[model samples]
Target: MSIATPQNPALAAALILAATTFIAATTLMAKALGTDVLGTPLHPMQISHGRFLFAFMGISTGVLILRPQFIRPHWGYHIGRTSFGWAGVTLMFASVAYIPLADATAITFLNPVFGMLLAIPLLGERVGPWRWGAALIAMIGAMILLRPTPASFQPAALLALTAAAVMGMELIFIKKLAGREAPLQVLWFNNLLGLAIATCAVLPVWQMPTPAQWGALAALGLLMACAQACFINGMARADASFVAPFSYATLVFAALYDFLGFGAVPDAISVLGAVIILAGAAILAWREGRQRPHDRAPAPAAK
Candidate 1:
């Protein structure tokens, strides 16, 4: 049986909000696991490994319970999506380990900007002047956030930016696969393939987690699974453009988690830059949402 797609707009909005909160919680968990902020610090790869491993466990269990026939889809697209997604996740975890959560999250918003550029060649999508202008504004926002100078440059920010770029490519693959595959199929393939690939790195530097650390890792995986489910359900229920803008709430949740958990506040420049980037993204989403009926294609899947 297919998963139920929510039809109520209010419920869909609530689900999106919940999904963003869960995503923000994952950043906090990842930071705690990968940094000395909480339990024993795990290597970024180990953290990535645990992320996918536990996510696979949780999602697979759900599939068994709700949709046993969901397995064994087209493997080629699955591999492509998982490969890009794993690389993106690894870099993003590394970025969070070194940089403030808010900063890293803000940099990742460039996925949409990069997506527009990739769409031209990959999907034969047209780019109009308005989107080009939005991309320019977003680029300026990235610069303002990075503040790349001899005295103020941060290499770590580049990691997040690179992750965003990889995720943009991943979105293109998702677009290709979405039409032929169910959302749960894509979700299962991501975690399952991610776990298999991440294991290679984990075996070399694995440290047995303490009970608390194990709990954290498990929670991280569960949150990710839940978040993805909510995200897909919301998108299925509402217009993709309507759902897309709420994703910026991840940054808000990140900033809040940073302040309350780590006491690391984003400086003025970072805040302003985040606002600008969000504005550009909103413009892009709004324009895409307004596309004529005949011009509509699948909107990029949310992370």
Candidate 2:
């Protein structure tokens, strides 16, 4: 068993904040790429394809410079993880194009709720009353945000929820992969397999991007890579539960982007639901943090 020593809290918080900002920016840029900000809107698949394609290019270049061994025997696990990740990205980008960025991003926070449910079956974990109550509250919050009246039903909101669920599964796969693989190996496979899957999916619907759109696509990939790196750094330096809450800042940044970039704002109900979801998620995070043994295994190294 390995013991964890806390790193500098201020730096961890700053890294997480920066990561969320980058991610929020990437989401807004992706929405613009698939919307009318460009002369012609790209397909969501095409946008996702560019995200992974360029990210792979950048990371692979770094890998060559760093000269890390990339071989791994866990092809099956990599395939499963990247496939879910690609699906989540497609759904998320599609939701972003159609909904307010804040609402879409808030819905994605349901990932922890979904992850808890998945752990029951996949990890053979038992759910106690506290967690079950938290899950119920989160579900209520999701329903509030969804507001699924016949006339008010939004398919985009459902898409965001689906993306969150897929992401939850991706997290589970990541846990499995982390047990046996290096962080860099997992990162490499994620980009490599994600690129291959996205390219094949986008080929039939692909439209050549204009110069401006191309720049946006490149920025999208760069921001995503930077965000991942920042998040990894933050997670490495602090207890995950301590830094994870800062991830909710993505909603704030997304809201700002939505208002300034698109003149869109979330309604009152959406705001209330977002608060409820955050509250429930906070409870879960707190419980997880408290349960973490001081003498437990050390956190894995950042990629």
Candidate 3:
């Protein structure tokens, strides 16, 4: 059964909000644990590898009992997406180490911008006037957030950008695959593929995590898995376009955590950039909601 209804906007919004919160927190938790708890240099590979191993195992167990037939489909998309996901994961985690969570999260939001660019070329998706305008505004915001100077160029930020580009491609592939394969199968494949790749890459650099770090890593893994599952379930309960904007809630959550946990406040310029990104995301979501004409109105929440 296709899992989207235009009538249920509120449900979709809540779903997106919850999912975004979890995802936003993952970066803050990963960076704090990797740097402070692990007592090791923050390497994206280690975090990604560790998180995926635990998440994959956790989800796979459920599949084993509920539906074992997912194994075949899992291998194909999982391996393919893991190739892209690894790059995205590596850059995202690295950015957390190199920059504040809000900054990294803001830059990562550039994924939608990349997706728009890719859609025009690969998917033949039209870049309508409003979307083009939104994209331009988002670019301006990106420049402000980056604030490049001759003396200080952040290669880490660039890696994040590259990762977003790859992630955009992965999104396109996943959307196509979603129609043909079960959601669990798709997720399983991606995780397993990432696990194999990460295991190989992290083996050389892997330092045994201290007990505290182990706990943090475990928490990170659980949060990541739960966040993703919540997102999928919530998206199923409502329309994608309605829920997509709620993804921006991550920015607010990230900013809050940065201040409270790390005492890191975003500069005015970064905040401005974040606002611009949110505006652009809002435009995108509006476009999608309109495109899905039959979307159910969000079910009213209890007073």
Which number leads on TM-score? 1
TM-score of 2: 0.90
| 60-100: candidate 1 lDDT, tens digit per residue | 99888887456457788788888888888888888898888
Give the range where candidate 1 is weakest over 10 consecutive residues by summed lDDT: 293-302
- Per-residue lDDT of model 2, residues 14-109, tens digit only: 998998898899899889997989859999899999899877887777778888865544888789878988998888898999888988888888
Q: How close is candidate 1 to the true structure, as a TM-score?
A: 0.93
TM, every model: 0.93, 0.90, 0.87
Q: Give the TM-score of candidate 3.
A: 0.87
What local lDDT does model 1 show for residue 248?
84
- In candidate 3, position 181 carries an lDDT of 61
Top model number, lDDT: 1
Off by over 4 Å in 2: 1-8, 69-73, 292-303
Give the winner by TM-score: 1 or 2. Answer: 1
